[model samples]
Target: MSHLLNRLTPRRGLLLIGLVSALALGGALVAQHFFGLRPCTLCHYQRIPHATLVVLGGLGGLLPLGLSTRRWLLAVGCLVALVGLGLAGWHVGVEQHWWAGTASCQAGGAQATSLADLRAQLAAGPAQPACDEITWSLFGLTMAGYNVLVFSALALLAGALAGGAPRPK
Candidate 1:
């Protein structure tokens, strides 16, 4: 495993990170569209960092960027991953009822003063899932829990790779 990790150049590492982000987004889409799992507002918030990382990693890996630029991108990716980790951890806490969720998580009441307002609210679409609800879990861990783990690993990998000293030519 160490040998494999050693072989991953900065370019390759960035590409790998982009690919992983893409895969994670794809999986979430599959779960939402095919499996019929609705995402809450917090879940939507958690995806933002992954989307940013996808662009950062892709640009750093695919473009003719300088070494310093690549390292900078990786450092940004690390920060994004840490932000994602925080979001996911917050979501897990919401799921476990350890704390209250955001206002958007409560979709129970949509007050409408008039018929037009009621129609507009109804036409807007179905209410999103509550953040506190655990839609799926494995080994007593929800998707947010898994996200915490994934983002933690990504943060560590990106930070380490970004800070690595360049080899003497």
Candidate 2:
């Protein structure tokens, strides 16, 4: 374990982080498409940070950027990861009914004050899944909960990497 940790320089760590982000995104997509798990508005929002991390980490790893530039990228990645953590935390709150989700998760159709309005609302499709509802869980932890853990660790790692660490060979 010590030998493996010693071998993980900043650049290499960034590459690994990027790969993890990509895998997480891929898994989310698979859960949505293959497993038929519909994502709520917040669920969709949670994917943005991972996507950003994928781009940042990939570029930082592949491009011949200077140390300062790489550090900047890692800093940006840290910020993105923090944002993801916040979103995931909020999602967990929503799932636990500690707070309400965005209006998109609620009934979509506008309130009908008249017959025409009612008809218009009826024409619209069914309401999307509420963000407060947990579609899946493992050991009482929702995907959002897992995201909180993952992004928290990622943010810390990115922050450390951004602190002028030596680049990997």
Candidate 3:
């Protein structure tokens, strides 16, 4: 694995990571805008790590950073990917009805206990789509399920990049 990492320079690896993150975010936007699929709370939450990776990868890949610095950035990216994985997994559980979703996941003020609370919720803008609702799916996997797979791969890739970054002479 280190041998393979040796061939791919840290700069190139970081750039690839950044590009992948950008594509993932862009795809989500396209789905929302072009397809009219409203995003739920968890869907929005899953994008945070990708956004961070875009910045980290851009800085590590494009800047005149030392090899050690690039490796550190890759390590951070690994952690961020792991965080994303957990969030996506949780979302999958919600979609599967394995567990209850967060309060904000209720799309119809289902969490309101009092008439006043319901009134306040109504006064707010339209409720977000329910996190548990599978708005889109492919092969029995929702977007969150696909995100789980992506994040897992990203975590592995970032870890490999960090470990494979050549040691400073």
Among the numbered candidates, top TM-score falls to 1
Q: How accurate is candidate 1 locally (lDDT)?
A: 0.86
Local distance difference test, each candidate: 0.86, 0.85, 0.86
lDDT of 2 at 117: 83
For model 3, how does the per-residue alpha-carbon lDDT over 1-169 read when each residue is reduced to its tens digit? 6576677777777888888888888889999989988899989999999899899989999999998889889899999999999999999999989998888898865668899988888888577798988889899888898889988987888898788635541
| Comparison by lDDT, 2 against 3, better one | 3
TM-score of each: 0.92, 0.85, 0.86
How far residue 45's Cα lies from its native spot in candidate 2, in Å, is 0.4
Candidate 2 runs further than 4 Å off: 1-5, 107-127, 164-169
Q: What does candidate 2's lDDT look like per residue over 68-102, in tens digits? A: 88778888999999999999999999999898878
The digit string of per-residue lDDT tens for model 1 on 1-169 reads 4565577777877888888888887788899999999889999998998898889889988998888888888899999999999999999999989999988888654678999988988988777888998989889988899889988988887887788868311
Identify the runs in model 1 with alpha carbons over 4 angstroms from their true place. Answer: 167-169
Give the per-residue Cα lDDT of candidate 2 at 46.
91
RMSD of each: 1.9, 2.7, 3.0
Q: Kindly give the stretch of ten consecutive residues in candidate 3 with the minimal lDDT sum.
A: 160-169
Q: In candidate 3, residue 98 scores what lDDT?
A: 97
